[model samples]
Target: MTTSLTIAQAAEATGLSVHTLRYYERIGLLDPVERRDNRHRRYTQEDLNWIDFLKKLKATGLPVRAMLHYAELRREGNTLESVIERKAMLQAHTLCVQHTLAELQENLAVLQRKLVLYDELEQAARAAGARAPRNSAPTPPTPERMAP
Candidate 1:
């Protein structure tokens, strides 16, 4: 098996654009790539695997600086200490993601309630007719306004 891939081949295999690969290296998200005898960049399968993890981190909203820090930890050593450090970082991020998900679910419930109320209001308005003057316009439904 060919253990080394040129930059273009790496890009193709990884589904990352060549420019993105270069940018990741420049931004410290990736370790420096090795160069061929002709000075072209070559990536090993290990590099490809690491890029895959970087893609996961980026997709999951890990900030660049934090990701860079994680990269630094990896470069320094792959000891038990580094494993704990990486797990801690991921554990923190997972908690944050969980909180975000909970908030989103609560918001979705509010939206659903508002939609039902809106449908009811629309039906009442049609029954009352457009020409029916109101004493005052309906109050805006902020989250606070939706109180019983």
Candidate 2:
């Protein structure tokens, strides 16, 4: 069995498209690719690992350039402080995303409550020999007319 994989095979393994792989290389997101016969791109196990790291960075919502910076630092060789700094950046971003998610959840709960209230109102309207569609717009508050 061959140790290296073709571009298409690498893309499938990495969950990225062949075009994305090419773009990654072109944009310096990936290190220079090793080619066989100067034509076919072949990926080694290291490349696969790099792709995996890139995927994790993407999942964490890091921008491509931010990931590229991390990749560049990583390629420079392992350093304790650099790793710490990168981890800090990711952690901060994760905290921010979690906060946003919590806010959205709260908003959703409020909207659900409003929806339930609307449903009750609709039922009451039906019982009173009045008819209106569910989710009908609420009346807008009007300003009192100014005395002449």
Best by lDDT: 1
For residues 1-148, what per-residue lDDT tens digits would candidate 2 score against the true structure? 6599999999999999999999999988899888998799999999999889788778767788788887777777668878887778778878977987899899999989998999999899989989766888777645554334
In candidate 2, the residue pairs with backbone N, CA or C atoms under 3 Å apart (3 or more residues apart, or in different chains) clash, namely none
TM-score per candidate: 0.69, 0.68
Residue-wise C-alpha lDDT for candidate 1, range 37-87, written one tens digit per residue: 899999998999999998888877889899999999999788999989998
As a whole number from 0 to 100, the lDDT of residue 147 in candidate 2 is 38
Give the least accurate 10-residue stretch of model 1, judged by summed lDDT. 130-139
Query: Candidate 1: deviation at residue 31, Å?
Result: 1.5
Q: Which stretches of candidate 2 lie above 4 Å from their native place? A: 1-3, 44-46, 129-148
Displacement of residue 52 (Cα, Å) in model 1 is 2.6
Question: What are the runs in model 1 whose C-alpha is more than 4 Å off?
Answer: 3-9, 12-16, 127-148
Query: Candidate 1, clashing residue pairs?
Result: none
